[model samples]
Target: MPETVFEVDVDEDPEDQPDPIVNRWHPDTPPAATIKPGEKVRIECLDWTGGQVNNDDSANDIRDMELSPNHHLSGPFEVKGAEPGDMLVVDILDLGPFPDHEWGFTGIFDLENGGGFLTDHFPEARKTIWELDGVMTHSRHIDDVRFPGCAHPGIIGTAPSHELLEAWNEREQALIDRGPDAQTGVNHETGDDEPPLALPPEPENVLLGDMDDDKLEDAAKEAARTIPPRENAGNCDIKNLGRGSRVYLPVFVEGANFITGDLHFSQGDGEITFCGAIEMAGYIDLKVDIIKNGVEKMGTDHAMFKPGYQDPDFSDYLVFEGYSVDEDGTQHYKNGNVGMRRACLDAIDYLTNFGYTREQGYFLLSTVPIESRLAGVVDLPNTCVTVSVPNEAFDINIDPDTLADDSVVTDRSDVAKPS
Candidate 1:
C-alpha cells in the first residue's frame, strides 16, 4: 500500500495556528493530525525545555527555567484504526535536528530539586552546548571528545484511557504514601511539587458548572501527566530507540492518541542526572501500524520494543563498579535507584582522576553514551551496579574501526573490581 505522509510542525506563530505544541500527554489533548494505520508521519519537536534553554543558554538560564510540564511534544496524532487493547507499532524511520538549527544542550539538575545520581558529590547545576554535524556530536566543554550520534525521541507513547490513568495515579500514590523513610526504592518525585507524591490534581478543563457526568469526565481526563512511563509508555527514555526501531505500545484509548517528543541527539542509559543527554529540537519520521488484540497476544502490560541502530559500534568500555550498601551493612535494593546513583558517583570519581574537574566529569558522564547495569541483585548485603562508558568516546589516539577487538581493554584495569 502507498503510505500517506502527515506533517506536524511546531506552531511558533502568534496567530492562525492549526496545530499546537502540547506539554502534557493527557488523553483529551486533541489530535494535531490523523492518519491511517499504514501512513507515515514527520513530526517536529521542541527540546525537553520547550525552547526555554536555547543553544546559547547559560547554566543560570537552565537553572532558572521552569522545568515542569516538560518534554514539549508535537502531536497526539490519532491512528485511524487504533483502539483500546490494540498495539500501536511505531517504526522510527529517521530522527535528527531541524534543518535550520543543528545544535543542542546537556545539563544536570540542581541539588535542591530532586537531585541527580551523583548529587551529593557534584551538587551544582551545569550546562554544556553541543554542536551537531549530521551523525556526529561535539561539545565545547569537552573538546577532546567527539562521538557518533544516536538520535532518538526520549518520550514516545500513547495516551492512557481514564480508567488506566486512574490506576497509574493510585499505584504511584500508594508508593508515595509510604513516606520517605519507607524503602519503596522507586523515584517518587514526578517533577511536580503538588501534594500526594507530586501527582497534581487534574486541572478543570472548562468550568462547565451545573453539569454532572461530563464535569467528572473532564476532570478525570486532566489527571494524566507526561512525567512517568506507565502502561501507555509516556517517557520511557530508552537511548537505543533510534531509526529503524519498532516500538510496541499497548493501546488504552481509542485512536491511541500517540504522541512523542524529548528528542535527544545522544544519551546514556538511566539518564542518572535528571537533565542528562544532548537535548535537541528535531524532526522524527515514523511509520505507524496497529496489531489487533495485541494485549492478549503479546502478554505484556505496557510498551515493548525492538531497538535499531545504524552501524552500531561495539567498542570496549571502561566499567566503573558501585554497590548500594552503607559501611554499617545496610542494603537498599528494592528499586535499583540507589544502586544506579552509586554507579554514577563511581563513574564521576574515575573521570576526575583523569584531569577533569568534578563538574566536568559529571557533565561528561551525563552527555556520553554510558550504560548503567545492575551487575548483581541476588547478592545479599549489597546490590552491585556497573556504569560502562565506551572507550572510543575518549580523546586517546585509537583506530575507531579496530577498537572493537577483544584484546583492547580500557586503561583502568587496576580499579577495584566488583565481587
Candidate 2:
C-alpha cells in the first residue's frame, strides 16, 4: 500500500463493482480491477517459445523442437491479498539480451521462415541475415540501411480458455512444421522432414492450385501492399532500445498470458522483414500485478510505451494487441495508425535532442507519409501493431553515453557504428 510491489493478473468485474475498464477480450464487458496510481509491477516476460530454444537454435533443432504448444508467458498471475476494482500496473524496467548470436539471425517473412510480404509466395525461398549489435547491419539488393531492434511482447494478454489454448497450440506447431519451415538448410528437401499441417505434399505455395504462379505473384505483391516489409520493402529497423524504456499492458483474462518471443537483431519501424534480428530465444524480466477498480482510478487501461518516442520525420512505430486477425486484421492496421500519432508525440520529444521544437517536429510528422506494418500474430492469443518512420528524415543529435534515466527518448548523435 505504501511502497512498490509485484503481483499477478487477478479476476474481478467492473460493472458489478465501482469503476470499470472495458475488457480487451470481452469488449462489452467490464474489467476486474480498478487499479490505483503509483502502483507498479515488474514483468519477466519469457521469450516466445517459453525458452523452447535459444541462441544455440538451429533449423534441425527447430524441426525437432518440442514445446507442448506453450505460449510461454511468465504468468497470468493472480494478485492475491487484494480486492477487485483496481488498476494493474506494469513497468518495462529491463530486458534480457541474447548472449549468443549464431542463431540470432534476422527473420524474414517467406514461407521458408514464415515471414516476408511475398513470404507465402517464396515461403520456401526467403531468408536474410542480421547483425545483433548497435549498428544493425542488413542488406537489400545492393543498398543497406541500419536500425535498432526495440523489442516487446508480440503476444501479451490474459489466459485463454482450455479450448482456445489447445487450438492455438496446434496452430503454432503447425506453422513451425508446416512444410520445410524450421529446417536448417535454405530450401532443402521437400516436406520429407517437415510435413504440412493437413494437406498432402503439394508444390510450394500451390495450395489447392487456386492461385497459379502468376496469380500468386500478383497476390504476393498485393499482399505486400500490407505485408510487413522485407525484400518487397526491406526491414524497417528502428533504434529506440539502447536503454531506459517502459512498456505497460492491460490484463484481460486471468494470469495475463504473456508470450514474448520472435527476437530480432534489429528491426525498423514497419518490421518489413516480418521479423526481428536474432530470431533466437531470450529472456525478459517483467512483473505483473492487479490493481482493484472501486478502490482506484485510471485514465485508461492501455499501455504507456517507453523510449517514449522517436524522430518526427521518421515513420511512427505503433504497438497494438487484440482479437483474431481474420475478422479485422486490416482494421488492426487502423489501430496501428493511432499508435503512430502517439509516436509522433514521442518523436517530437525525441527531436528536441536534435534541436527541433515540439512545433517543428509536429509540422514534419504532419507532412510525412508514415508507412504501416503488421508486426506479428501469435496463435489466437495475442497480436501486434507496427509503425515505422524513415531514419533518413531526421538527425539523431544526442550522445547515447550520457542518456539519463527519467526519459525514454534518446539523442542519436552518439550512435557510432558499433566497434
Candidate 3:
C-alpha cells in the first residue's frame, strides 16, 4: 500500500475533519500535504457532497441539497519542484470505495435545484443505490440490470492563478447577469425560462484548508466554485480516466497545488443527471512527475489526459440515434445539445417496452457503462448524436433482432422519490 499523505473520516462532516477540506478554488489556500515528484502516494477523498446524501429510500436529499458547499477536495498537495508554466503529470494508479462504504448512489436533482440534462422531461427528484461487489454493481431501486463499474476519480485539477481565476469569475458572472438562457429550459426557483447559466462565488460554507483567519474572509468572497471545468480541468467528469491514465495539468501557481474529489463507481457518458454517476467516498493511488516547462512543449493551455487502458469491453450494443431536432419538433441548426437529449430520451422510451418506468430507465442509464457518441457534427443542417447501451447489461435479450418485450422484467419496481 502506498503511504496515505491525507486521510478523512467518512462518518464525520467534512468541515469538522482534522485536515481542512476546501470547497472553493483559490491559489492562496495553503497546501495540506506535499509529495516529491516520481514518488507514489495515496489520498482519500469525500464524495462531492461530503456524504450529505445517505443510503436511504427517499430522494429529499437530492431535492434540497445545499449546492454552495460542494466537491470537497482532499488536497492542494504541493509537488516538490513544481512551478508555474510547468505541466504536473498525474498518473492514476488504482482507486476504490472504502471497505466499510462499498455502496454508492446516483440521483436526479429537482428543477428548482441544479436539475439535469433531461430535467424538463423528468422534473422530479429520484435516487438509486448500488451495492458494489468487487467490480460489478447492481441496484435495488432499478431492476433487471447489472454491469461492471469503471471506477475512477470524477474531479481533479491544479489550482488556478489569480489572473485566470478572475477571468473565470468575470465571464461567468456576465452570463449570469444576462439571466438564464432561453434554450436551456426553466429555473423553477426563480421562475425564469432557463436553468442557471453559471454558478458564481459564494462566501457561505467556504472551506479553505489550513489558511490564516484574516485571509479567509477575503479569499472566500473571490474563490471560484468547483462546478464547471475550466482551463485547469476542475470537474471534467470523464469516465474513461481510470487506472493507468496520465493527466497533464498546467501549473498556474507555484508547487502545482493539485486538489481532487468527487469519485464515481461508474457513470455513463454525459452523466445526464446533474447528480449522476454512482457517487462514493473513496481513495485514489497516484504517482506524480513534473515535466519542467511541459506546458510550452505541448502548446496546449488546458489540461490533457490519456484514457485509461483497462475499460470494460462490450461488443454488442443497441444504439439509438437523434438529429438536431427538439422534442417538440422545432428545427434547430447544428445544436448538438438538443440532439443528445433526444437520443437519451429515445433510449428511455425503448426501456419502457421492457416494463421499466421512464424514471427507472433514466436512473439506470446514468449508472451504467453506456457509450454516447457524437456521430456527426460537420454537416450543415443537422448534427447527429447516439446513445448506445450494452446488450449484455441486462439478463434477457434486448438486441434489436430479438424484439424485446415486457416479459423480461415482470416484477417492476420504481426508484425512491421525495415524500
Candidate 4:
C-alpha cells in the first residue's frame, strides 16, 4: 500500500520562525519529509498566491491583493547521497483527493498600470477563474457537457538560477524605470505592432489592494524594496508538482539551488485562465539529490514529466514554447529546433525507450496523450521550454513537483537524431 506520510493538518502558528516570509502559511509541520522508495505520501499546502484569492473569493478580491514571495517548496532536504548529474528518481506513490473548497488557485499578470501582458486587452492586473473538480467537456462545444476539474499548477520546476537576481540587475532597473510594460504593441525594432513583450523580471512588489491609503503607502516602499526572484524562478504554482513528480534542474549555484512553493490540488492541461484546482495548505516532503554539470530533460518515459494532481485517465502531455526578440528585432528559439516533427520525434524516441511496444505506444499516445508545457520568452539567445508527458506512457515515477531536481536524464548532445 502507498504511504501517506506528508500530510499536515495541525496548522502551525504563523509566527513560529524568523523571516516570517517562510512561515507565511505553514512549514513542513508534518514530521517525516522523506518517503521510502515504495511509500505513498500526502502534503499540505496553502494557495499558490498566498491568500490573495480563493474559491469563495472574487476576481475583484484577487485584483486588490498583496502577496509575498513565499514559494511553497517544502525543503532543501538533502537526499541521502545524491550528487551532481545523478538523477533523483521520484515515484508518484499515491495522489490524495481533497474537496474543492479546500484548494484555491489563480494566474498572475501585470496591467498597463503596472506592466502586464497584452496591455491592450487588459489595462490592469487580472486573474481568470478556472475549475479543478476533475471533470470533462465536449469536443466542439457541440454538447453542453463540462470537463472535469483536474486542478493542478502550471509552473513547477527546479531552482537553477537562484543567484541570477544577484548577477542580473544591470537591466532590472531599466524595466522598473520604464514603468508598466505593454501587453501587446509595436516593438519599434521589429516594426511589428502585434509582438508580445519578452519575459518580465521576477522582482517582487506589493499590489495596492484594498488596504487604506496609509497602509498602502507604508507597505509600498518595503514591498518595492523587495527584489523579485532574480533566478526568475518565482510565481510557478503548478498543481502537478504537489504529491509526486521529480523535476530535473540545472545546478547554477551551490546547494543545487532548489526552490518550489506554489501548490495546487488538481489542475487542467492548459490552465488557460489563472489559478484554481486544489490550491490549499498541505504538507510537502522534499528530497534533494545532485546531478553533475548541466541539467537536461527528465525521465525516459512521458514528456519528461507529469502534473502532480491529475487523473490517470487524462490523456495528453503539456509542453511550452517561449518567444522573444532583441533591440535589433532578432528572434531566438527555446532550443535551436523550430520543427514540430523534430520536437515530436524528440518526445517519441524518449517514450519508446520507456518500454512501449512500438505499435501500442503510437496508438496509446495518439489516443488520449499530449504534452504539458511551461511558457517563457525574454532572456538572451535562449528562452524556456517545459514539456510534460502523462504518467500512463512512462515507466518511471517520481516527484518533480516538491523534491529537488539535480539530475540530467539524457545528454543534450545526443537528444533527437540517433547516433
Candidate 5:
C-alpha cells in the first residue's frame, strides 16, 4: 500500500461555507488539491445526498432533498504529469466508513421526479437503512438478509474538455426532447407531454485559482450534469470497482482533474432503484497515474473509452433472465435501454416470487452485489438480458431446480430444406 500524502475531511467547515463540496466538474473549476502521479491521497467523502440524510432513518429527507448540483465530489486532484488525451489509471487502494459513523442507505425515487427501472410498476418513494459492521451489512427493513460489505466510490471521473461538454449537452438534450412516451415506447392516451428537465447551467465566478483567459470562458466552465457516464467516466456506478481494482479513465483536460464522491457501502449492478444504494460517507485511498495519448495509441473508440476495470473479485451467480418483448410476443429490439429496464423489472419480479414484496425486491436488487449482463443481443426478434445475483451473498437456499430453464435450443433441423 502507498503512503497517504494528503487528506480531505468532509465535515470541515470554513465558517458558514455556501457549499461544502464542489458540485460540478469543469476545467475552469480550480483544483482543490494537487498531487503527483503515484502519490496516494485519502479523501473523506459524503454520501450522494451530501449530509441531508442523517442516522435517524429519515425518508422525508430523501424525498425533499434538492437534486441540483448533486453528488458532492471531493476534489479535482490535479495529477502533476497528466494532460489531455491521456488515460488516468486510478487504483482502488482502500475504502471504508468514516471514523465512528458506520451506516448507509438504499431507496427508490418517486415517479414524478427522475424515475427508475420499475417506476411505472412501483412508484412510491421509499428508503432502507443499512448498518455496516466490519465486513458485513444488515438492514432491519429487509429481515433475514445480510451481505458482505463491498465499498467503492460510486462517482469517479475527470473533467471533460470544453468541446466534449457541449457535445454531451447537445446529445442529451436531443434525447430528452424525444419526450417520455417516445423514449419508453409506451403511448400515453392523455398525451401528457412533459419536457425533460434541462441541465442546470454552469455557475459563474467559480474559478478559485489563477487561470488562463481562454479557460475562463462560459463554455469552458460549463459542463453537463453528472448523471450519465460518458467517455470521461462521470457517475459510473459500477459495483466491481472496489478494493484492488484498477480503473482507466480517458483524460480530456490538463492534470486529468480527477474527482470522486457518492461513496457506496454496497451496490448492485444497474442500480435499478435510483435513490438508494447503501449510500455512505467514507474515505477512499486512490493511487493515480497517467497514460499519455492513450486514445490514439490504443485505438480506443468513444464508447470503449468510458472506464475499464481490471482484476475484479468474482463469485458464483444465481441468474434471472428478461427479454425485450411484450407478453403477446411482439419484439422490440431497437431500444436496448428499454430492454435492460425490462430485464431489471423481471429480476425484481423473480425475487418477489421468493417471498420478497415488490418494494423489498427492488431494494434487495439495489443494495446486494447483483450484476446485470446482456446475455444475448443477436437473437432475431427479442434481445436477452440477465441479472446475476451472487449466490454467496445470501444464506437462503435458492434451488436451481425450481428456477425456469434459461437454455435455448440452437438446433436448425426444422428449417425446410432450403425450398
Candidate 6:
C-alpha cells in the first residue's frame, strides 16, 4: 500500500475532520499535506454532500439540501516545487468504496435547490440507492438493472491565482446579475424562474481547511463555489477519469494547492441530474509529478487528461436520437444543450416502455454507464445528439430487434420521493 498521507474518518463530519475538508475554491485554503514530486499517496474523501443525504427511502433530504457545503473536497495537498505556469500531473492509480460501505446514491435535486437537466418535466426530488457487488452496481429502487462500475473522482484541480479567482468572481456574478429574464442565448434547463445563472461566493457554511479564524471571514467572502468547472478543472464531472488516468492541470499558485473529492462509484455521460452519479465516500491512490513549465509547452491554459483504458466494453446499444427542438415544439438553431436534453428525454421514454416510472427511468439514466454524444453540430439549424444505453445493463432483453413484450418488466418500483 502507498503511504496514506491524508485519512478521513467516514463517520466524522467532513467539515470537522482531523485534517479538515473544504467546499469553496480559494488559493489560500491551507494544504493538509505536502508531497514530493515522485511520491504516491492515498487520500480519503467524503461524498459530495458530506452525509446530508441518507440510505433510507426519502427524498426530503435532497429537496431541502443546503447548497453551500457541497462537493466536500478532500485535499489541497501542496506539491513541493510546483510553481505557476507549470503543469501538475496527477496519476489516479486506483479508487473504490471504503469497506463495509459498498452502497452509493444518485439524486435529482428539487427545482428550488438546483434543478437538473430535465427539471421542467420532472420538478421533484428523487433518490436511488445502488448496491455495489465487486465492480457491478444494482439499484434496489429500480428493476432489471445491473452494470459494471466506472468509479472515478468527480472533481480535481490546482489552486487559482488571485487574478484568475477575481476573474471567476466577476464573470459569474455578472451572470447572476443578469437575472432570469435574460436567456443568455442557450436554452438551458432553468425551468420557470430557477436557480441563479451562476452561484456566487457565499460566506455561510464555508469551510477552508486549517485556515485561521481571523482570516476565515475575509477569505470565505471571496472563495468560489464548487458548482461549475472553472479554468482550474474544478468539478468537471468527467466519467472516464478513472484508475490509471493522467491529468495535466495548469498551476497558478506556488506549491500547486491541489484539491480533489466528489468520488462517483459510476456515472453516465452527462451526469444530467445536478446531484447525479452513484456518489460515495471513498479513497483514491494517486502519484503526482510536476511538469515544469509544461503549460507553455503544450500551448494550452486549461487542464488536459488522458482517460483510463479500463472502461467496460459493451457490444450492443439501444440508441435514441433528438434534434434541437423543445418538447413544446419550439425550434432553436444549433442548440446542443437542448439537443442533448431531448436525447436524454427520448431515452427515458424508451425506458418507461419497460414498466419503469418516468422518475425511476430518469434516476437510472443518470447513474448508468450510457453514452451521450453530440452527433451533429455543423449540419444545420437543428443540431442532432444521441443517448445510447448498453443493452447488457438490463436482465431482460431490451434490444429492439428481439425485445420482449411491454409486460416484460411487470413488477416495477418507483424511486424514493418525498411524501
lDDT of 2 at 306: 52
The clash count for each model shown is 0, 64, 0, 90, 1, 0
- In lDDT terms, how accurate is model 4? 0.36
Return the TM-score for candidate 6, rounded to 2 decimals: 0.96
lDDT of 6 by residue, 222-284 (tens): 999988998899899999999889999999999999999999999999998878899999899
Per-candidate Cα lDDT values, in order, are 0.69, 0.34, 0.89, 0.36, 0.68, 0.88
Q: What are the per-residue Cα lDDT tens digits for candidate 1 across 1-419? A: 22323233343531122346566656666677787887776777767666666555357766666655465676778899898989999999988887788888877666665456666665666777888998888776665678887678889998878777677777776766763423343435653333235444345332111225554466545555677677777788888888889999988888998888899888888766678788887788888899999998999867999989673494778777778764244776543666666667766766655545566667677777777788888877577788888878877633445445655444331111112
By summed lDDT, the worst window of 10 consecutive residues in model 6 runs over: 181-190
Model 2 lDDT per residue over 53-148, tens place: 333223333333332222222322344433323334444444434445323433323243343332322243222333445323333211223444
For candidate 2, what is the lDDT? 0.34
lDDT of 4 by residue, 123-219 (tens): 3343323333433311110111123333333333333332343334335556534443365455545655442322233334433222355654443
* Candidate 4 vs candidate 6, lDDT winner: 6
Task: Name the weakest run of 10 consecutive residues (lDDT summed) in model 3.
Answer: 401-410
Top candidate when judged by lDDT against the true structure? 3
lDDT of 6 at 125: 89
Estimate, for each residue in 144-180, the C-alpha lDDT of model 3 and write its tens digit: 7888998888889999999999999999989886776
Lowest lDDT 10-mer window, candidate 5?
A: 410-419
Candidate 5: tens digits of C-alpha lDDT, residues 268-382: 8877788657898878888887778876776762322222243225477777777777545577864456667666677667665455667777888888878777778887766
Candidate 6 Cα RMSD after full superposition onto the native fold (Å): 2.7
